[model samples]
Target: MDALSLLANPTLRDIGAGAILVLVVLMIITGRLIPKATHDREMKTAITRGDEWKQTAEETVKVNAEVLSQNSQLIKANEVVEAFLRSAGPSPADTSPVGGP
Candidate 1:
């Protein structure tokens, strides 16, 4: 019964309203304290998977940076070698990969 009925018939509905009120108050209090998404098993799993993806993305960026740096160094070294070769003109014994006269 509602609070008004329970109040009018205190002998019959003595603890009914009080019990419902306590339950509602408890729910309100706990809802504020508890995290909604973490309570869900699927949501917790999704959060963990999101963290894994973030870590993977960070690792990918780090590896890509290292590869880019190595490529830059290789390009610089190749330029230096080509400049030396052009200055030296064709060598009789030069069997380099670039192949020259």
Candidate 2:
């Protein structure tokens, strides 16, 4: 009986219109907030990626510096070995081609 009364009354129509208006207002509010939320998320992601790239660049520079230091030490050792060879005479097995007939 209550359902039939609601269906037969103008009050029920007013209540339905008010409910629709509330839903429309809520939809508009959510529509405005969604883009702001998406922008915030994208900015956070960009910052994280930038930080990761910076760390990787720093690590690459450190590794290259270590490799350069090692290479300098190796070059010094090679020069010392070459100097010792120059101070010592050639072995008997090392014949000079310049003296060949």
lDDT of 1 by residue, 2-83 (tens): 9887678857666677887787889878874455655687678989999999999999999999999999999999999999
TM-score of 2: 0.56
Clashes of each: 0, 0
Q: TM-score, each model?
A: 0.51, 0.56
- Angstrom error of the Cα, residue 84, model 1: value is 1.2
Per-residue CA lDDT of candidate 2, range 16-92, in tens?
77797888789778874356778899899999999999999999999999999999999999999998987796676
Candidate 1 residues lying further than 4 Å off, grouped into runs, are 1-39, 91-101
lDDT of each: 0.83, 0.86
Please give the distance, in angstroms, between residue 33's alpha carbon in candidate 2 and its true position after superposition. 11
lDDT for model 2? 0.86
